[model samples]
Target: MDTAKVVATFSVGIAATLTATALQVGKPSGWDELATGLLFAAFLAAIVVVVFDRLTDANHGNLIQLAFVHGWTQERLLKELQAATIAAVDANSWVLTAVRISTVAQVGISTLSGIVAVVSLLT
Candidate 1:
């Protein structure tokens, strides 16, 4: 929960801020409307996923921590990691998901901004 909240809080805040700004100042037509809709949807999804992830982590992380601390010895940790590869998987999932999502959103914004700029120029 803490980890997810740590990630989600800032992300949601940023998305809310960006979508709100886009809604206010975005171009009136052409691709702007579509861009606005997609941005707003993504913002909403970010909020939802952030909340869900935090709730999920809050419930699971504690148990995992406890298991690691008391139930698992160093040898066991090594064996478990070797067998299930959980830690590596979690790290990889977190890193990849964050990077991929951010990259996609960046590209989306750049594309929409380019569309708006071109349309603005033509108009």
Candidate 2:
């Protein structure tokens, strides 16, 4: 999750740089415009991923805190902890899947944007 956040942050920076360069090229061709749009989209997507991951982490932390607060007896606390563990596993699985999909999307869009930018420059 931390790695995903780091990569997403890096991707956003790259996307911004690419978009700025595309805009500065002056009198962009259709391909340059397309590259800029795709870079913007990629940047937005990375931001969303980072936000969603942070939210999910906060929610899980709250859940764990609630479990400790509510559990009265030793047995109850153990049970609560076990339940929290299961829930965490499920949530982490889903989060990992989402991160994987978003990472693939970011990479694909960034690659395509780079290609289009290069083509625009060459033509």
Candidate 3:
């Protein structure tokens, strides 16, 4: 089994379990509530990334094949593709930055939220 896929699946399973527990327990502390929201957002972001990546992969393969058929050198094709604009941002950076930022934010906020939730529960 792919380790990364297994870990991702585990992460999602944990999130779902926590969500269900949170719903069944009475009103959660603010920290718990925030954590749940962030987890939900993180899941949504994952879905969006998967969809966008699949869409781009389709275009990426086609572009490479087209370039090959036209006798364009790999290096030149890569340079042009990297410099190309997608949604007004550099093709290479736009989606990547978005996906990275969201993932980082999700992880950071989730950690912070977890800490706060633990403290709140202890107090």
Candidate 4:
């Protein structure tokens, strides 16, 4: 239900998937090693997100309580409470963005790696 929890959960899940894939995807050739490296990068980036989420959640408790007491109504408070502060929210947004970019990068790298492997085989 909480954003931080969601982020942590997803990050952990991604990390687990990446680690498993990397372990299972044995390198048949050099290009495959490169792809494995990209997967590892994704796993590391996801781990960074999980750490950031924990830090953000730890610091935002007071802000959330404040928003609860000061916000005008339940619905409005719920919306506002989504962000503890503009700066923190922005930082978290950046973290999420980084995670997504890392994920995309991993996929792109994997695709290219596959292409290289195919090309190598053909040659």
The prediction achieving the highest lDDT against the true structure is: 2
| Sort by TM-score, top down from the best | 2, 3, 4, 1
Off by over 4 Å in 2: 54-76
Q: Tens digit of lDDT per residue, candidate 1, span 1-123?
A: 345444544544454454445556645655455545555555555454454442112234454575677887767655554545555566557655664565455444444544553443345
List residue ranges in candidate 3 displaced over 4 A. Answer: 1-30, 48-90
Mind giving the per-residue lDDT tens digits that candidate 4 earns over 1-123? 145345544544554454445445554555445545554554565455445432244245665677668765766665565654655667667667665665555444444444444443443
Would you list the C-alpha lDDT of every candidate in the order shown?
Answer: 0.50, 0.72, 0.54, 0.51
TM-score of each: 0.34, 0.72, 0.45, 0.38
Give residue 23's lDDT in candidate 1 (0 to 100). 51
Which pairs clash inside model 4? none
Off by over 4 Å in 1: 1-27, 45-106
lDDT of 2 by residue, 1-118 (tens): 6787778777657766765676677687898789888888878777767765732222445655766787667676566667767776776787778887887787678777777776
Backbone clash pairs for candidate 3 read: none
